[model samples]
Target: MGEKGECSGVKPSDDEIWAKLVPSDSRYSDVEIRSDEKVICSEISAAFGDKHSWCKIIRNSDLCSATVENKSPNTILVDGTEVHNENTVVIKDGSEIIPGPDKGGFVSYRFDILSSPETSQRQLQICVDVENAKCSICLNIWHDVVTVAPCLHNFCNGCFSEWLRRSQEKRSSVLCPQCRGVVQFVGKNHFLRTIAEDMLKADSSLRRSDEEVALLDTYSSVRSNLVIGSGKKNCRKRAHTPVDDQSDGTYLQCPQCVHEVGGFHCNNNTVHLQCQACGGMMPSRLGFNIPQYCSGCDRSFCGAYWHALGVTGSGPYPICSQDTLKPISEHSISRIPLLAHENNVHEQNITDSCIRQMGKTLQDVVSEWIVKLNNKEIDVTRLALNHVETINARTSVCCDCYQKLVSFLLYWFRISIPKYRLPPEASAREDCWYGYACRTQHHSEEHARKRNHVCRPTRGSNM
Candidate 1:
C-alpha cells in the first residue's frame, strides 16, 4: 500500500489533471494523474512509473469520469467488480479500486477528483443572437463580417466593400448600410467572423453556395481596420462669399472648381474624395499618376495631392500639411505607438523596457526593422493593411497607418531577439499559452506580466 498525497493549494489548468489516486496504505506514494491516459503499477511514481503495465486509466472526453482497463493478467476489481484483462470499467470520483480480486494483502486506492472540468477550464462564453450575426446588406449569415463605426453596424465585407465603392463614386460621404450614421471607421471583425462561422456550422442550411461565396470574395476589398474619415461630410461646401452671377449655392466646389490646376478642372460630374484629416475635397483621380488615396488604409488624404499642386490650407478650402501623409520612408516614430502589441499595455511596456535595456532608441530600432521590411526580408502576412503586398518604403500612408506599420515592424523586432538577449526579468517569464492571441492578456495584469505574449500561440485557432 502507498501513502496518499495531500491536496495542494494551487490548482492545475484544463490541460492538466484534476484528479489523483490516494492509496489506502502509507507505504506507497499517491499517484497524481497529469495526462489524459495514465497507467498505474507497483513502481509508485507520480509520472509513468508503471513498468509492469498493471492497468491503464483513461480520462474520458468529458474530463469528469475515467475508465480503468486491465492490462496485466492480475485480478483488478473496480468497485468490487472484476476487470478482466483487456476489459475496462467506468470510474468516478470516490470510486475504489483494488489491485487484487479481494482487498486482503492487496493495495486499494480511492480516486478523488479535486475540481470539475467546468470549474478548471477558463473560458468566457458570450451568448450572441444568431440573427444578429447576419449581415444586413446580404441578409445572410455574415460572410467575412466587417464592422463600421459610429453606428457600430456590421455587414459582409464584400457587400460593404461594393457598397463603399459605389458610395464613393456617387457621394463623398459613406453611410452605414443599416444605419444612416456617417461611417468614421471600418474593419474586419474577426470575433464576429468566428461567430458567423460557428453559426453556419451549426446550421448548414443557412450557408450560401460556393459560387456565391466566391463572387462575394471577389468584391471584398477591405483587408484591415480603416479610418474612413473625420466623420464630416466629404462633399465640397460652397465658400461663404458674396453670391456672384457665376456662383450657385447648390453645387459644391474644390480647388479645381474655381480654376484649372494640373491641366484639369472639376466638372459637375467629377467625383470627389474628402480628406480624412482636414475634411477638404479633391477630385477622385483613379488612373492619374498623383497619389490621392493612402495605399495602406485606402483613405483619401489631401496632403500629398495638395502638395503636388502646390496648394496650401486657406479659408473654407482647407488643405493639410505635407507631413500629414507621406511615403513610409519619410515617417518616423519617437516612442512606441499605442496600437502596438494589439494595444496590450503590458506587452507594450515589456517591449519598451526591452528596447531601453538594449540601449537603443525606439526610432533607431524602427529604422533598422523598416529596412528589413523594405528589403522583403520580413513577412507582411500579419500586417493589417490593404494592398499589403504592394506596400514598401515608397508607399504613401497616413499618420494613423504609419503607426500601424511601425507597430507591425516592432512585433518582428521583439520576436527576433534571442531569449538570452532579453532583459533578465523579461527572459525569466514563461510564454503565455495563447501568445499574442490571448484575450486574457488584455484584462489580467498579473497573467500578462507573468507570461510572454510576443511568441506564437501554443494552442487555439490562433496557432
Candidate 2:
C-alpha cells in the first residue's frame, strides 16, 4: 500500500533508537560532584614551568578538576579551539548522547559562562547534545517524536498521515514531503505510534530508575555525612581536660582518662589543645591560627589542628606543626648537552665536491680507473651528473630530434648511457625495434669498449 500523490516525511526520537541499540543494564558514566567541594584548580604556571606544565591534579586535594572539556560551552572560543577530552565538555544537556541524521551524537552539559566567568552563575544554562547525534529514522529530538518517511524527511505524524491519505488517490507511491515526487514508504500512523511507544517506554524506565537511585544514593551519602558529624562531635567532647588538676599553666590533662594527655591549654589570649605525651594537637573551641600537639609519648598524634589551619596555605606538616614530616632530600637536575654544534666544514668539503662534478663528464673516469668511495662499483653519481640535463630534456624534446640532438649532446659531454628510458604506455605496447633506440645502445657499448671502463664508486656518489 503506497500513498498516492502524497508527500512522505517522519522523524523519530533518540530514545526510540537507543531502545533497541543500547543494553538495558548499562549504567551511563557521569561526573560525580559533591556540594562541599574542597579543591581549587589553579591556573597553568606557564611562566614558571619549563615544559608541559599542565598537571592532572594540584594542591593537597585529589578531587578537584580543571580541564578544557569540562568548561562551559558558550564559554567556547569562537576561534574554534577544540577542547579535547571526554567528560570535559562544555555542552549543557548533561547527557553524553549526540544524534544526527546519519547516526550518533553525544550530548554534553555547558553553561554560557566562558565569556563572563565571574557572572556565569547569573546567565542562562544551555546543553549541547554531542554523542551519536543522529537518527535518519527519527527526527532526532528526545523531546518530540516525528515520523521518518522512506524519503528521509522528518515531519509530524498527524500531518504526514493526512498527506499520505491524500497522495494515494492520485499516484502509486508517496511523493517526498518537500519534493512531492513518488518516493517509498506507505504513510501510516502505526509506525509513528510504535516509535513513540518505544521512546516512552525507554524514557519512562530511565526516569524512574534515576529518581529511585538518586534518592537512595542521597540517603546513603547523608548517612555517611551524619557519621562524620557524629565523629567530629565526639572528638570535641573528648578534646577537653581540667585546668584545676594542673598546678602550672604549662600543662593540661584529658578529661576522659584524667591523663596528662594533650588537652586544651590556655595562653594569655589564645587556646590550643595539645597532647603533652605524644604531641597530638587540636584547635581550641575558640579561634584560628592556634597550634597544639598531643603530649602522648608513643602513639602517633591524631590531627585535630586542621580546624585552626589557615585556608590560604597548606596545612603545617607534623615536624613543623605536629603531624606532618618534611622530605629528607630534594630533587636536582643537570643540563649537559650530549651533542656539540660545529660547522663541520671539513666533512662538508667532501660533500660539496659532488656539486662541482655536476654538468661535467667523467674527466677522471674517461682517463683512469676509479676506486670505491661509499660502496657501489658503478660511477652512478658521475653518470647522473653528466646525463642530468639530457635526461631532463628527454621528456620535452621532439621525437625526431631525440636521436641526433641527444646523441650529439652526449658525445660532446662524454656521458655514459645507463638505461633505456622508453616513453610511457609506448614501452608497454611496443619497443623501438629498428630506429634510434637500437643505435643508442650500440653507441653506449662502443663508448664503453673504447674507455675499457670498469665501473667504480667515487666521493659524493649517490646510487
Candidate 3:
C-alpha cells in the first residue's frame, strides 16, 4: 500500500482513490472488475499540489491498517489523536482525517466503505424445453450438438454425419436441414453440448439410452470444424478461392476467416474465440500475454485484440476496449465490493463492527489476513470457490475473483479469532447447519446475519 511504506505522492480524486481501494463485497465474486481504469495507487491525500503541508492515507501493511500520514510538522488529529510529521494513525470507516493543525485548513474527509445493492436474485427451477434441443431429422434431443455454418442451423452430430455420408455417395452437395442453405462448414459446438447435457439431467426423459448414445457417437464425424462441400453439386463448382470466399463456397465464414485483419489470416487450423461482448472472431492465444479470455466468466473478449492490433475501438471493424481484459494483478482496487461474504451483507456488517471495536478498519483486517494467506499461515482446505487449488494473492483474477478471495480470507480471519475476542453480538451466535452453503444466505439477509456460518458442527447439532 506504500512505496514499501512511505507516503509522498500527489493527492488523488475521490473516484481515483475508490478505484484503487478494494473493500470486501460478495457480489463481485462473479462480476468483472471495472476494466476501463488505469491508475494503481494505494493511498489518498487531502491536499493536492501542496509542497510543504498535507494529509495522506498511508498503507501500513506490516501493521495491517491504512494510517493517516501527517506530512505537515504541525499537529494533525486523526479521530482526535494528535499526529506529528511522518508518524501515522490507523484509519477506520467513517473516521475523520483532518489536515493542518487543529482542523484549521478545513480539508477533511471520512474513511468509508461503499456498499452496492444486493444481487441474490436467481430464477426458480423449471421444466426443460426438450423440443428446442430436438433435431429435425431424429425428432429427439440432440445427441451431440453440431452447428452448420452459413445457414447456422444446429442438429445432432450423428444425424448430420449420416446425411453427409448419403449426400457424398450421390455426389450431391449437402444442404442445411432447416434453412436449405448449401452447408459449407460444420463444427461440434462444445458450449451447446454442455447445455444439452444439463437439459437431459434436468429431465431424464430427454436422454437417449446408452446403446443409442454409443451408436450416435460412432456415426458422429464433426470434431473441431469441418469445411463442408463447396459450391453446388447443391447448385456448380466455382473457381478455386480462399476458404473464406463466399463465391467459392456456398456458406459464409466468420469475419476473421474471410479476410486479412491485423496483419494476420486465419488458415485451416486456427482455433478461434468468439467474443461474447461483440461476436467478433480473434485467434485464440493460449498462454500468451494478450488476454483473450475473461477470467471471471470464462468467456472470450476482443478487448485484447484491439490492443494487440494497435487499433482503437473507433476502427472500421468492431474493436473492443483493452480495459475489457487484462491480467488480474494489473487491476488495482481500493474498496471492498458490497457483495462480499457470499452476498451476506449482514456478515460483512458484523465483521466491520468487530474490526472497528478492535480499533481497526476493514482495510486493516483484510491486509493482516492477506499477509497470513501469502505466508501460508492460514489453511485453504474449506474455502468455498471454484479453482480453489490455484487461488492465491499472486494469481491473476478478474475483479469478481479478487472479491471471492477476500471473502474467503475474511471468513478464515473471523473464525480464527477466539470466541471471547469476537464482537459481543457475534460471540453469542450459533453456527448454521448449511455453513457457507445455506440457501437462506441468498434470500434472507436477517437469517444470514443472525447465524454464524464460520463454526464447525457441534456434537449434537443437525448434520
Candidate 4:
C-alpha cells in the first residue's frame, strides 16, 4: 500500500486523490479511488456474475496515475492487453478497463483523472521557422500577412496592396509579385498575420523601421478580399456607319438602335453600364443570366453581352472581342513573361537558355505544365493567386492572368529540372543563399550567374 493509501507504499496529498472509474454500463455508478484505500471492482460485479473482488486500483506516487491489479480468478484486460490475476498494470486518465478476459458479457469502464496535474499548467512550446514567416516581396517579417488566391502565397498587406496598385496601373491585370500568377483575389490572412506578429514579438530585430512601416501602411488599400479585374482593352475595329442623332457626343450609340437583342430592347429609361474595355454603353439588365460584367473584376464589359446578342463592332457601336475576357482555357501563351522569377532578368535569361538547351519552346513547356496543373499533380501551396483550388484549364481568367499563370508554371518548370539536365554552365552554378528572394541577383551580374535563384532561401536574411 502507498503512504496515503493502505494498498500501496506511495502516498499522494489529500487533494490529489482524483482518479476514478466511469463504468460503460449506465446501471453501475462511478467508483472513486482514494489514496487512503484501494478500489475493488464491486460496483460493476452484477454484470460480471458475482460480487467477488475482480480488480483493485491502488494509488501510485503520481496523483494522476494509479496501478490496477487483477484480483479475479479469471483473466481480465486493461486497454486491450491481458492482465492475469495478481498482475498490476499502470493506468492513467482515459485508460479503458474490462473484466473477464475478452469483452463478451463484462462491462467496460474508463479510468479518468478528474483533476490535471500541476505540471500541466506550464506554458507550451511550439517550433516555427522564422524564415517562413517573412514576406517574399519585402524580405522581412510580414507586417500584415495577406494571402492571394490561385497561388495562395502570403505577403505583407501593405506590400501586396502596393504591388496590386502598381500592377493594375501598369497593366489591366494584376500579377503576384512573388510567383507572377494573375491575382484573381487578395485579402488579409488573419492566421498568417498572427504568426508573423508572434515572430516579430519574439525577435524585435526582424521588425522594420517605424518610418518604413508607416509608409507601407499608407499604401495599403486592401482591407478585405478584393477581386481584381483584367484591364483588357477593346481591340475590335469599328465599321463605317452614321452616328445616332439622339446620342450626345458623350455617349456611344446603343445596340438597341439597330434591333432588339436577346428579346430585350434598350430604351432611354433603361439604366446602362459603360464598358471599361471599349468606350461603349450597354443596357444593364440585372435579371438576365447574360454576363455583362467581367467576373475577374466586377467592372462592366460589353464584349460578352454584345457577343451573346450576335452584335459586332460597328462605327456607331464599339464592342470588344471575345478574347478580351474569356475562360482561362481559351487563353494561350507564346512567349515568356518578363514578370517571371520575381522579374529577375538574370534568372529569366538562364531559364531561356535552359529551355533552348532542351530543344523545347516556352509554349511547349507551359502547355505541358498546364496539363499537370489541370490534373492536380502540382502542389500549389506556394503559388500566389486567389481561388487557387478553383483554378483549372476551364477557369475564367483575363489574358494578363493567363500570362501570369504561364509565368508561374514556368517557374515550376525551371525549379523541377535536375542539375544534370540543365545546361553544363548553368548546372555548374550553386544556389544563392536567399534563393528567389535574393536581392543581390538583381544588381550583381556575376553573383546572379554564379548562383541559382530557383531554390528556397537557406537563410532568413542576406547576412
TM-score of each predicted structure versus truth: 0.54, 0.15, 0.43, 0.44
Which stretches of candidate 1 lie above 4 Å from their native place?
1-252, 357-359
Alpha-carbon deviation at 351 in model 4, angstroms: 2.4
lDDT string, candidate 4, 284-329, tens digits: 6655776664444445667777887788896467788777767766
Error of 2 at 40 (Å): 11
Question: In model 3, which runs have C-alpha deviations exceeding 4 angstroms?
Answer: 1-263, 267-271, 278-280, 295-297, 354-386, 441-445, 456-463
- What's the distance in Å from true for residue 410, model 4? 0.6
What digit string (tens of lDDT, one per residue) describes model 1 on residues 296-319? 877778888888887777645768
Which digits, one per residue and each the tens of the lDDT, describe model 2 over residues 1-463? 1000100122222221100111111122112121111121221232542222111211112112223232222222211343322223322211121211111222222111111232232344334342222223233322222333344554434344345445445444455566564443322234443454455554554232456434433322100000000011113324443333232222232232132223433222222234333343332342233323111111122233433332211423221232231110111112111110012222122222332445333333222212221223333333312223223221222222223222232222222422232222222322222222121223233221222111221211111
Q: Local distance difference test, per candidate?
A: 0.74, 0.26, 0.58, 0.68
* Candidate achieving the largest lDDT: 1
What residue runs in model 4 are displaced by over 4 Å at the alpha carbon?
Answer: 1-253, 256-259, 267-273, 283-300, 381-384, 461-463
Our tally of clashes for model 4 stands at: 21
